[model samples]
Target chain A: MNEQRRDVLDLLAEGKITATEADQLITALERDQPPVASSSDTRPRGRAKYLRVMVDTLDDGESGQINVRVPLQLLRAGVRLAAVLPPQVLERANAGLSKSGLPIDLTQLKPDELEALVEHLDELVVDVDQPDAKVRVFCE
Target chain B: MPQLVTVRVTRVNRRPVRIWVPVLPVVLVLAPVLVLAVLAAAAACRVYRISVARALGSGWRVISALPGTQLDIGLGRSAVLVTIR
Candidate 1:
């Protein structure tokens, strides 16, 4: 199978595209020779993995939590976003919190800690078929 | 029994990791900027470490109704664990 066809098939497998949409993709792939645009460095091709995040509002006081199923590429995106801000915000945010008598140290967090605490996220891809497994995000 | 509450879900964009090393000389040289820089770096780092690579690409709609205040998110045939709080 050609690269475009392979990508279309992969999207089909991921349940990202409908039967009609998949047909359109396949048709387009065949017609476009020499590839009008390279899939790489342009935009990723294929059905995106999905992550379901929810905030529950309950009488038991459980509404601030989020649960998500993330792809590795999305995880990388999340990491990249998290890295955009400087490191001291954590300390400053925590410092303010501490001043208010909350005992938490944001400066003491590791990469994994940040992942666990983040409320938002994104994704990336490596190959057409060899995508990584899903990541589970749970708020404790 | 605790009833299921309303849940909010927001999609975040991909970001890069930011690091700020506060050396004594630099800190002494730049106090206020150093603090701001540190804050910026930390925020960037947090964004970078987010678990995106392995996450689902599309944004998800939160279903507030679920089993006992807890959410049993469907991941295909399998389910993932989600706490209400």
Candidate 2:
């Protein structure tokens, strides 16, 4: 019951505004105000520890599955390791990565960029469902 | 902080075989060797005009981040699982 909401209700009670108008006004007020932060929303983001990949498939009464969990720290460390590599090696790596359909430049990978990528990955999820197969990738 | 790694393998109509490996003692034993290796690597990096501190730091980070990794593969009636924790 904020002041704006109370004012709207008071106007409705006093017959200055109709109930429908009061409802619309309150809705508008809520839309205009910034969302209140909850405990979880206030917490810092990118607390995820691992990236997981899961796959399950069934074929002709046979089933197959695979699961993998990789620590996010490992990715950070790998980027750091790449930072120390020779320029020629990095150039070769970039070429290979590009050839493999990933146009990432190892030379341009910085701690800040890596952190931003991890933060974005925190909210990334991929799922595929088929008649006899399922796949999922996410961070947790 | 994880101290052990567990590996399990199962086959159709057979009991699961589990192996427990203690990581802490192994890590402790290798600590000195790792320090020496880092020092040698740092010297090498210095010759190459690379940052010795970053190299050492990254190496340590990789090793320390090895725990909590897991992998599982299953086909038909056989399965293999590896967990570090």
Candidate 3:
């Protein structure tokens, strides 16, 4: 078994998480990790190396926050992909229009206005959409 | 002991090349021109190829912070900074 898979199983056995939770964690880990490449045709081998993206959520009062440390390569990829997406993706990903008059509100701007802003911030965004309600990715 | 593998390398000059060619029919001429345009554009990009072998060479270390939280990661002379909003 891979290191990530083994780590997940260890977590499950410790009763820190349920079996289903372990499966979900494994799936997410696999998506970011490629398979191991062995020199021989068949052998028990070590897990492949990869940039590990660790995501953690915290609740403070009524607000939720997340912090992530990603590899530079992954960061570059996200920045490139974010540059090409339509404004609707950002708007929809934010869940709804922000009532706060923060300069980041997209719904307040016209299509042309948003396009102009995107041209300037092409290097600062990433697009990682959440797959379920339990988790919402705030950053690319 | 570390084992080394040998591989052949091919180098291509970046300067535009001059070629003498026969004039083709109009239909053939347009297709070759479009093909050449695409090839030139593709060659112009500075391609950075990160092979899978290289990527899987080392295990990456990660550090993360939760919402309403902050963290700092470093090595050797290490440091940690946390500010909550």
How many backbone clashes does every candidate have? Answer: 71, 0, 5
lDDT of 2 at A20: 91
lDDT of 3 by residue, B1-85 (tens): 1012122222243332332222234336599786786455444322323232322221111111111223332222222333322
Candidate numbers, best TM-score first, in rank order = 2, 1, 3
Residue A14 lDDT in candidate 2: 96
User: What class would a CAPRI assessor give candidate 1's docking?
Assistant: incorrect
lDDT (10s digit) by residue, model 2, range B1-85: 5679999999999999999989888778899997897778888998888887777777778778888899999999999999988
In model 2, pairs of residues that clash are none
TM-score head-to-head 2 vs 3, winner? 2
By lDDT, the best candidate is 2
By the lDDT metric, which is better: model 2 or model 3? 2
TM-score of the second chain in candidate 3 = 0.21
Q: Is candidate 1 or candidate 2 better by lDDT?
A: 2
Stretches of candidate 2 above 4 Å error?
Answer: A1-46, A59-61, B28-40, B43-47
DockQ-derived CAPRI band for the predicted complex in model 3: incorrect
Scored by TM against the true chain B, the candidates give 0.26, 0.68, 0.21
Query: What TM-score, over all chains together, does every model reach?
Result: 0.22, 0.69, 0.18
Each prediction's whole-model lDDT (CA): 0.48, 0.87, 0.42
